[model samples]
Structure formats: structure tokens, C-alpha cells
Target: MASAAEQLAANMNFQAFAKATELHKRIWFTLIAMVVYRLGCFIPIPGIDIAAFSQAFQGQAGGILGMFNMFSGGAVERMAVFALNVMPYISASIIVQLLGSIYPPWEKLRKEGGEAGRKQLNQYTRYLTVVLALFQSFGIAVSLSSSPGIVDNPGPFFIISTVVILTGGTMFLMWLGEQITSRGVGNGVSLIIFAGIVAVLPRYVIQAFELTRTGGMNGGVLFMIVVLAVAVTVAIVFMERSQRRLLVQYPKRQVGNRMFGGDTSFLPLKINTSGVIPPIFASSLLLLPATVMGFAASGNLPAWAESWLPGMVGQLQHGQPLFMVLYGALIVFFCFFYTSVVFNPEDTAENLRKYGGFLPGIRPGKRTAEYLDYVLTRLTVIGAAYIAAVCLLPEALIGFAGVQFYLGGTSILIVVSVTMDTVTQIQSHLLAHQYEGLIKKSKLRGGRGR
Candidate 1:
């Protein structure tokens, strides 16, 4: 049997959507914003030889650059203005999140202060983003200049110009994301990333077929890859929705003329408390070496370091044992690290105590905190293993096939998670629209009676 809410949702149709003016407006705005972002991906940065860079990029496509390129909607390959994309912003956020845990003042601001503090933190992130962007942009400029034929004119002027352009581009993208978040549906940053990943799907499909036609990949392998992607997506959905629910009981109380009652509820903790962040953080950290090397390798390397550098980089290739081990280790580290930052067992216990609520058989203050932490630690171990497996399995396939299917499991996880979140938001908006219509009809009926 369906609940009333479920029944209402089932009954929703074109008529309901047509009635939702705000939803229509938001949908249109989101589409337009996405289109704008896509257009930006093609606007090439000046003073770079596109043809040469494209050819050079092909050689590096099997490595870390491929992953970043996919996330940037091929902007990096195209050497577009948005080539840097929102990666600097993401790096800044990671830094800020880490600081919140270790730095006393930042930790206090994050935990104790509310909305205003968050706004302040966001400001700090933006400033840090500019700094990261400039550093990355300078490296890119230097790399391009050093790489033969990649830059038409290589000098101090080109370096300065490239850094300025890329920094401005990244900042513009950051501002655009903020606007979308404030006025549109879903999370702005995630949606931008989602759009970038989706934008390259057609190209990936074409590439897969091209490989098959060229006899580089057989039909069986292609089919297997397709099946693998579907299986991974299904697994991710199940794991993401899985939760541990802890029962809480409120004691019965008596007021002078009324009875205030006992109520039972559950605190739901998601299996993946860290969400898609662990892989993103891990990948970004791993990518730094490759990305920096790609941008700097063409530049004059010291005679002493040249021999070992290339071999060291080769060892870190995506699917190699060394890379896999480090990737998995980083994912596990960030899983616990991020989960602890966001969810404090002590704070949860304090809030429960303040509200006269207690977990079944547990004291409300320190004891409750201890109990929660114990459960959380166990859950996190399992969650870390799950995330590590999901993120690494795709990378391992790189050795057997040209399965450049969005670089690795991290990209797939991101695409699927963002899609799920967007759909959820749309459903929520539709439900709100239905409520508005019901309220309007009630007001009209009352007026008629009056």
C-alpha cells in the first residue's frame, strides 16, 4: 500500500508540472547557465597553438590528465579559458576543511558560529582559490612555453598573460557557480561538474566505437565495460542509500493541565558519511604530481633530476600497484578525516541532552558521545573499504582495456551521485508546488463560502 504522499507523487503528470511556474523558471535558468558553461569550455585561451596542444594532449590522455580533462569538459585539452575550471576552488575547500579540524580558531569558528561564520569561511575559500589558480596557471604557462610548438610565443609576457587569463577564468566560473546555487536548483558546484562530465559522454561513446572499428577493442570488451558501468552504478546507489538508524527515546512528561509525551525516533547515519568527497580529494592530491609534471616536464629540468623523475612518474601510472595502493590509502584516510570533521559525536550528544532526548540505554552526555563514536568508527571502517573498492576497480581495468570511461570510478561516482541529487531536488520542488496548489484551492473555497 502506498502512503498518501507517495500516491500524490504517483499522480503527478504534465498538468502538475505545467502548473509549477517556479519549477519551470528554475529549470530554464539552470539549462541556460549550463549552456553558458559549455560555451566557455570552447573559448580557447590566446597565444596557444591549439593544433599542437591537441596532438600533444593525445599522448597524455591515458593518465591523470584524462581524468581532469573529463571533469573540465575537455577544457584542458582544448586549452580553453576554463581549462583550470573549478579545481582550484575544490582545492581551497579541502584546505579550509582541513584547517577547521586542526587550527583552533578555525575549529571554534566552524563548530560554534553559525550562518555568518560559514559565510566568512566561504570568503576565505575564494581568496585561497585565486592563489591556487595563479600558481597552477603559471605552471601551465611555463609548461606550454617549454613544450615545443605548444605556445606560439614563449616568454615572460606569455607566462604573465596565461596566468592572468586562467586566474580570471577560474574566478568567473566560481562566481557563476555561486549565482546558480543562490537562484537555481541543485548544488551549483556539483551541477557544473555534472554538466562537464555529461558533456563528454557523446565523445566517449564515439571513441569507444572507433576503438572497436580499429580492432583495438573487441565487441566483448565493450559489452563488458558497459555492463561494468551499470553494475557499478547500481552498487553505488545501494551503498549511498544504506544507513544505520539508532533509536532514540524521549521520556514522558506531565505539564499542569496537559501531558507532554514520549516519542520515538531514529538518528539516521549514512554509510558513506563523507559522500563523494574522499575520492575527489584523493584524486586531486594524486593528480597534482601528474598535472604539475605535464605543465613543467617540457620545461628545462635539472640534469640531476631528469633520469629519476620520469621513472618515478611512470610508477604512479593510474592502474599500477603503487598508484592503486596510494589511492586506496588516501581514500581511507579522507573518509575518516572528513566524516569526523562534519559529524562530531560530542556535539550530537550535547544537542540530544539539551532537547531531553537520549539514545536507548545510553546516558545523554559523555556516555552517549562515547557510544556514538564507537558505532561511527566501526561504520567508517566499512565505508572506507567500500569507497576504496568502488574507486579503484575501474582504474584496474585500464590495464586490460582502453576503458577511459570517465578516467576512473571517482568520475562515475560523481556523475551518478550528482544526477541522483538533482532528481531528488526536482521531486522536492514538485511536492512543494502541489502543496501550493492545494493551499490556493482551500483559500478560494473559503472565499466562495464567505
Candidate 2:
């Protein structure tokens, strides 16, 4: 049977949406913000030779740069101001989150300081973002300088300007994302990334079709890829929605002849508690060494280094056995690690016990914690395997098929997950609007009765 909320959602119509003025405002704000981001993707940075850079970028388009370009909405390809996109911000946020668990002071703030602490940590993340952006932008400028014809004026001025422009662009994006989160719909950073990917998705699709038409790719292979993509999307949705519910019973209590409690609830645990983090982390780690080696090999390295770097990079290519194995192993490792960080069985057990709730036929304290940990461990195993399969299979197939587009499992996961989150937020807003309408109607009736 469908829940009341689900039924209400099903019955929601255009009329109800029309009445949600706040939601309308938020939607408009998000759209405008995304438009601004896309526009920035086209505005190239200063002092870069556009034609030279484009030619050089195309040569390395099948490698890591291609993946980054896709995420940046072709900003990287254009060497745009937003070439860094929100990646530095994302890395900073991840670093902050991991530190919050390990660092004693930050962990205290995270656990006890509440809202104020969160703001402080966000400030820390922003600072870290600026640092990382500066570092990355400097590296990029140096790399471009090394590649002849890419930098128009290869000097200190050029490097300084490149670093400032790219870092400033990243900071601006970070601020824009914060605005979206406060006044718009969905998470600002995620929506920005989502917009970037969706914006270029059509071109990728058209390219696929063009490849099929030009006889560069077999028609049957194209069809298989399309089918595979759709299948993976379906699997993503299903697994994302799947949950394991643990029943918790609250015993009845009597106080002054008033009975309370005596209720049952199920704690819902998602099949994939870690979400898209594992795949993203795994891919980033796996690609970093390859990217560095590729860049080094292109530069004026010594004969020994040059000879070995290219071979190492070749071995680490997408479909290679070493790459695939490392990718899968990293994904599995991060899945378990992140899950452990996010969900603490002992804390959950303590909370349940404090609230006088207990799992049926189980003790309410330490034993409950053990049971929860055991269940979560089993769930993580399945979750890890599912994530590995989803990410690796399509990647291997695409690499083998010589597909140029970087439409891998991570992209699919991000698109599906972000879409689902945005839709859910919209529905919640609609529900809130409906509830407000009901309250207004009831008050009007009461006023008239009086």
C-alpha cells in the first residue's frame, strides 16, 4: 500500500505548483545561477593561445583531461575562467569532512557545537578551497608554459594572472553555490555540477550517433551502449531507493494514569549508505597518477623518465587490467570507510536505548550495537560490489569500444542521484504548500463559524 504522502504526491497537479510562489522563486533563482555558470564556462581565461590550446587539448582528449572537461562543461577544453569549476571546493569539503572525524577539535565541533560549528567548518572549507585552487591553477599555468605555443606570453606575469583568474573563478563559483543553497532549490554545488554535465550531454549523444553514421562505430555496438546506459540508470534508481528496515518497539509507560509510548517504528537504512562518494574518490585517486605521468611524459623529461612514463600511463589506461583492479579495490575500500564514517552503530544503539526503544528479542545496549554493526557490515559488502560493478563494467566496455565520450558510471550515478534529490525537494515543497492551504481553509471556516 502506498503511504499517504506518496498518494498526495501522486495527486499533485499544476495548480498546486502554481500556488507555490516560494518554490517558483527558488526554481527561477537556480535556473539563473546555472545559466551564469554555463556562461562562465565559455569565457576563456587571459593570455592563453586559444587555437594552440585547443589543438593540444584535442591530442589529450581521450585521457584524464577529457574526464575533467566533461565535468567542467567543456570549460577545461576552452581553458575558460571556470576551468577549475567547483572541483576545488568539492575537494576541500571532502578533506574537511574526513578531518572532522579524525581531528579531535573539529570532531567536537561537529558533534556538539551544532549550527555555529557548522558555519565555522564551512569557513574552513572555503579557506581550504582557495588554497587548493591556487595550487592547482599554478600547476596548470606551469604545465601550459611547458607546452610550447599554449601560453601566449610565457612569463611570471602570465603564470600569476592565470593562477589569480582560475582561483578567483573557483571562489566565485563557491559563493554562487552558497547562494543557490540558501535561496534556490537543491544543493548549489551539486546542481552546478549537474547543470555542467547535462549541458554537454546532448553533444555527446549527437557525437555517438555521428560515429554510428560515419561507420566509425558499429551500429549494433551503439545500440548496445544505449541499452546499457538505460539499464544502468534503472539499476541506479532501484538500488538508491532500496532500504533495510529494522523494527524498533517502544514499550508502554504510565504517568498519572496517562499512557504514552507503546509504538513501533522501523529505522530505515539505505542499501548504499555512501552514495556516489566511493566512485568519485576511486576515480580521482586512480586518475591522478596517470594524469601526472601523462603530463610529465609530454614535457622535456630525461630519456629514462620519458621512456618509462609513457609505458606506465599506457598500462594505467581505462580498460587495462591494472587500472580496473585498482579502481574496483579503491571503490570497495572507500565504500566501507565512508559508510563507517557516516553511520555509527554504537551511537545509533545508544540513541535508541536512551529513547526506550529496542529491537524485538534483542537487548537494548551493547548487544544492539553489535547487531547493528553486523547488519551494516553485510549491507556494505553488497553495496560495495554493486558500486564496483556499476562503475567498472560500462567503463571497460566504453574503453574497449574506443568510445570518445567520458560517459562512465560516475557520471550516470551523479545525474541519477542529483535528479532524484531535486525531485524529492520539489515534492516536499509542494506538500508544504498544500498543508498551508489546508490550514488557511480550516481557519477561514472557523472564523466564519464564530
List, residue by residue over 6-41, the lDDT tens digit for candidate 2: 777887999989989999999999999999999999
The true-structure Cα RMSD of candidate 2 reads 2.1
How many backbone clashes are present in model 2? 0
Clashes of each: 0, 0
Off by over 4 Å in 1: 1-12, 401-407, 438-450
lDDT of each: 0.85, 0.86
- For residues 1-450, what per-residue lDDT tens digits would candidate 1 score against the true structure? 996679779878889988889999888888899999999999998998899999998877767778788889999899999999898998899999899889988887898778877888899999999999999898888778888888888999999999999999899989988888877888888888888988987888788888888887888988877888888899999988889999988888999988896998899988889988888788778777877665555456799879877766665766777778898999999999999988999999999998899998887899999999999999999899989988899878876565544446787888988888888888889988887878899999999999
TM-score of each: 0.93, 0.94
RMSD of each: 2.2, 2.1
Give the TM-score (vs. native) of candidate 2: 0.94
